[model samples]
Target: MKNSRGSLVRPHPLPGSASRPVVTPLSPSVVYASDTPDALDDQYEGRVFGYTYSREGHPNGDVVAARLDEMEGASGGIVTGSGMSAVSAVLLGLLKQGDHVLGGNQLYGRSLRMMAEDLPRLGIDTSLADPCDVDAMRAAIRPETKMILVEVVSNPTLRVADIAGIAALAKESGALLVIDNTFTTPRAFRPFDHGADIVIHSVTKLLAGHSDVMLGYAVARDPALNDRLRVFGVTAGLTASPFDCWLAERGMLSFDLRFDRSQETAARLADHLAGLDGVKRVLYPMRADHPDHARAVQLLGDQGCNMVSFELTGGRASANAFTKAADGLSFAPTLGDVGTTLSHPASSSHRALTPDRRAALGISEGFFRVSVGLEDPDALLQIMTDAVAAARAAEG
Candidate 1:
């Protein structure tokens, strides 16, 4: 018999059973013990399938990574602590000090800053170009350009890039084509199908469908590239927590249903708000008046995205009024919640950019981005109408 201290310190695991639970069990252990030194060595060398430490990898992360890889049609991938970390792993891991990166100017503000500002300090050069124009991107690429980063549909603005065109450009220049697919998940667009070398996602967004988890993933088409990213991710300590991975997996179970309903509602709201009073412009990829309408349809199909961006006639004051007077929607700095929410790009996402840069991207003080949720379509429309009226009154 063991002493009380020994018993307390090392409790025996429950008996193993053949029956499996319907849901994937969450294994939160930070370290795993191998039966033998040989077994441990095999795990470390990738000679066998297992894990030694959570930072290197955990079971949950692997499961989620595999799921995302399958969804994106990738051979393999890695999940990271956050979306930015995933992007960081790719850029920092692949590029040398003197390498250049050609990126889209209208990516999420943080991503834009990372490429345009942060990478430059590290001896890496970057150039931002129009995402929707292949010729503009081609003109920006240099001989040293090692990576071409872009998004299918830009954030806060509904500009759609010609992925196939940019992919061809990357191939010609011997640069890796990396795409951020957060705005249009695999449900709407699969970057890999269009020749993307790497596809990234902010899993905190629509992938998780809840405002709860902050996770991200990068899927690589090539197994060798995936291996490099995994090494970098492990070394940089960018591995995701087990609980977040579990939550993301659970959220994705109902992703299709939530995505369809919310997408439908977003389409309804964007169309209705286009001609409404106090609205200067509505930017929905599916809208005929949108600049990328044709390309968006060709790439994203008729489904469109759950996000809607619009400009208020009164600028900042009208935006503030609209948020204040809006019913059933709250002003949030983040998005991808089951509940509808609004984001002010000028103050929140793109506040770091200079006024000139922000203006160049068409992000005015009056610009508003909405993440339509699983709400009644008729009720949401009425709420939007009433809010617009209230905003106009406040502006007047």
Candidate 2:
């Protein structure tokens, strides 16, 4: 017997618990109770598995991390608030002052900016080089190089890196190779299979399938390095909310189905666009004309990727017209949505780069990146064909 308020605060416990539900219950509690001080100490000290605080350790994050670990074939992993946060945790955790990073120039623009601009401010030097050119990457590696960061498939331009070749380089140089596998999820390319020390993913995209959740994670092949990343991730306050983690896990339930459909559609879309009059060059990893076609084949098999980029004959005006005429198609700044979407590099992902830099990377004003979705291939093809006509009409 207790006062009303007291009774309300501490409700009667259900003798035990119901049978486990199929869907995981979201535990969004910021803090959890401990039976005793020694128990909590043990939890914090990693003597046993348990949650103390959401920011430090939690059930939801652990579940998703474990799932990703199994998917990426790693012993351990940690989920962060976002993809960039995951990258930040890895760089800050692994490297110290005076260490150097040799990063791919064609990585996601934000990632490249972080390595080239932000890392240097922390006394960590970075050199940007073409990851496709293994010889150039080897030459660029310095004695102090502590990390070799690259993407499985570069963003926007769709360049495919030689993961095994570069991994060998990293090993020879005694540098840890960190591969960003956002574009090529574990279903397509598991970096661990090719000697990658660490694999990172923006689970917001393909892993989650839908575009609703914002989550990311880093999986480490070595347990020691994974533990270090977890410590830094917790210290840096990069942990994600339980709700987001739960949603991401739910999204992954249908990952294989969504990935396979979108990838198949993207291959067809690339072919359709290539034959259009207003298109200059279509950038799809599997395309025979693509410079990295051979490497892409060896790495990704027949399924290249769901992302496709192509240049319009009329540049920005043509792109503007195409989007305007292409009714029902979303012009999202982000990628990996269930529905087909378009992104303009000049305005979205690579907008921060100088004009010369954009040109050097072949991200022209006319360049449009398509995040192929679960839409009907024939319907998407028709929409694209009409849009190309509109683009040409505007150019004239």
Candidate 3:
């Protein structure tokens, strides 16, 4: 078979399979049979004869990782049980007791929590800096800092960081630059292009497109790091299920189409929301008034993924009213779904943080993060506008 570019491609088949079939969704197996003692020995030694056990390795996960590697321009990649697992594995695999990590203050709530609480328990120190402030990040770095971790586009707030600048700093500091590329998938931005040493993704989100599967991926620009991550994943039992890997691969097929549609809708909605009466602030990187607009254009170009965050003037009351009035839009805590959804940071993603911390991050009860879907932009805008008006009216 040949791809659209007319390059010859061979079918991916399982090693132990008798049939040379084109369409192969390799069955999930706990253990694979070894024909000979030599083959078993090779499997035990990690000689790559094929998967010996599902926990160590599997065909479905390998296929998905290979594809992610190709997309992200990574040397190697591994699939994990969840996004947090991918983050934890990479940190655990690379850093030791004395190592330090510099992370973005605006990271996902769970990530921040892990950095603040979990890494310290492992005897690793962490410092959180404003991702938008390169100087602050530089100042925060210590001699023991082994990794600089940040999201390509921050969660909830949608703040765009300077990946290239951070990468340069990390290189000079002898630290690895690790980016959570979950927001802008490889379709929109390849972290390697900006000198990221490692790229992480929550395949549960955009790559899966549909909200059905939970998977994570870590793609390494260095082969050694990749090997370390894989070993850590296998040893720690962080492997994703074969069925989820298979489903993720299938979802990746239409990722480009889904991404483009949702991104376009989000851009339009950001503009609409900016002018809406009840909206106090709109934070979309593509918007000219956004603080990181220039950086976003430099890094992501016009491809701003499906996220637009806005605040209501009436605080929590208006937000509650707006969500209640939004007929078709679901108030989902998650993002990257095909259907339009809204997430409340104060009550969901950022809920883990204290009220003071949430205030410090500019996340309030009025703030709402919208994950624009593949729905028609015009119709979605109308529904959103009506919802806002109703919310304001209710406040009056």
Candidate 3 ranges beyond 4 A from true positions:
1-22, 46-48
How far off is residue 269 in model 2, in Å?
Answer: 0.5
- Score every model by TM-score: 0.97, 0.97, 0.93
- Candidate 1 per-residue C-alpha lDDT over 1-396 given as tens digits, one digit per residue, 9 for 90 to 100: 766666575556668999988998998999988899999988878799988899998988988888898888776789998999999999998888999999998888889889877899999999989978899999998999999999898888878998889999999999999999998999999888899999999999999989889899997888898889999999999989999999999999899999999999999999999979989999999999999898888998897989999988887778878998887797997777899999999999999888888888889988999999998999989999998987787776
Q: Which 10 consecutive residues of model 2 have the lowest summed lDDT?
A: 9-18
Computed on alpha carbons, the lDDT of every model, listed in order, comes to 0.90, 0.91, 0.89
- Clash count of each predicted structure: 0, 0, 0
The deviation in Å at residue 158 for candidate 2 is 0.7
Query: Ranking under lDDT, best-scoring first?
Result: 2, 1, 3
Which of 1 and 2 is the better model by lDDT?
Answer: 2
Candidate 3 colliding pairs: none
Using lDDT, give the best candidate's number: 2
> For residues 1-396, what per-residue lDDT tens digits would candidate 2 score against the true structure?
667766586566536666767888899999888889999899878799887788987888888988998898876789999999999988989999999999998988788889878899999999989999999899899999999999988998999998888999999999999999999998899898899999999999989878889898997888899889998998899999899999999999898899999999999999999999999999999999999999999999987879999999887889899999887899988888899999998998899999999999999999999999999899999999999999998896
Candidate 2 backbone collisions, by pair: none
- Tens digit of per-residue lDDT, candidate 3, span 181-265: 9998888888888888899999999889788889999978878889899999999999899999988888898988999989988
TM-score of 3: 0.93
